[model samples]
Target: MLRSPKDPLSFDSREKIALFIDGANLYGTAKTLGFDIDYRRLLEEFKSRGYLLRAYYYTALVEDQEYSSIRPLIDWLDYNGYKVVTKPVKEFVDQTGRRKVKGNMDIELAVDAMEAVEHVDHFVLFSGDGDFRSLVEAIQRRGRKVSVVSTLTTQPPMIADDLRRQADHFIELAHLESRIGRDPGERAARAAERQDRFARDADPEDI
Candidate 1:
């Protein structure tokens, strides 16, 4: 059974809520649990709790690529209800002479969350980065409830202990699979579509 609004972990139907999704982080977490998030279901799940003020999705895009694997999902989110924030990935050579791509959206997420404090009564962050612990505490101090969504069911645990402890509520993503996970058949269909696109885009001689 779901807890009542009186519970610190539960939401009051009247409160204003906003979702901040760390796209890469969330994708990695869900993949570890062998599931894919159904964004439409995710939005509905929260909208049922309160007035959903906004659903923000943050990601880093490789601008140099002619076609990015994540472009389709980003476009879908933009067309849907999500507020997508994207930045270009920075590529650099590491000390060991290995190429690496860096695109951390922590600052952007934090800034947006802080800006929402005046309008939102609840903040739902979809990332387990321990770095957000301080941000969670700050939001709580501002008198807004903060819920951190991530999973601790994996071998190494996807959530940081500090972040989980700091949040007013810690929602394990594994527990939400049934509510927001994509159906296996639907996932297969999407996968096949992506493969077909890839095939069509490839050079005929390479096929």
Candidate 2:
């Protein structure tokens, strides 16, 4: 059985910690696991573990759009103690005549982590990208601990083996589902509230 968050092997309460969340990666992993992360719960979980110096969330935004699906989540995170870093996604057409949006925030996250190392004793990286292996190794060299949060419970696994091995500790996201997962009932309630609001705003003639 996987250990819980309270397990001593997971974190040191006395240490100063910082969280680096790769937003897109985390969302993809959680969706793959058939769950949604309650960001409030996730922050509270780690805050209870140690002195949470910072919690940084990174993502790419579709700038030209009048509305983005991610905007609300980003706003919520920003208002609720998370430092959000975002950049406009670049749209391009390939030789195959397919359009694509590129918005990788790996470099931004790495730079922030490196800058934060001086103030934090523990780094909790919420990403499965193997490209961060070098960043993890560098942080470890600074005499601080690094804990990676990703899941291996999925068929192909969400975490990269190289990145997993590079970290000083690995905390499977599956083990944290109980603490950070969103309640289905809460989601239903929110949906109902939205429906009620829509009904209130509806035109009588349209109805």
Cα error, residue 73 of model 2, in Å, equals: 1.3
Question: Model 1: per-residue lDDT, tens digit, 14-109?
Answer: 999999999999999999999999999999989998999999999998768889989999999999999999999878899999998887999999
In model 2, the clashing pairs are none
Query: Model 2, residue 140: displacement in angstroms?
Result: 0.8
Across residues 52-114, which tens digit of lDDT does each residue of candidate 2 receive?
Answer: 999999999876888898999999999999999999987888899998887699999999999
TM-scores of the candidates are 0.88, 0.92
Clashes of each: 0, 0
Quote model 2's TM-score: 0.92
Off by over 4 Å in 1: 1-9, 193-207
Q: Tell how far residue 143 is off in model 2, in angstroms.
A: 1.1
Number of the top candidate by TM-score?
Answer: 2
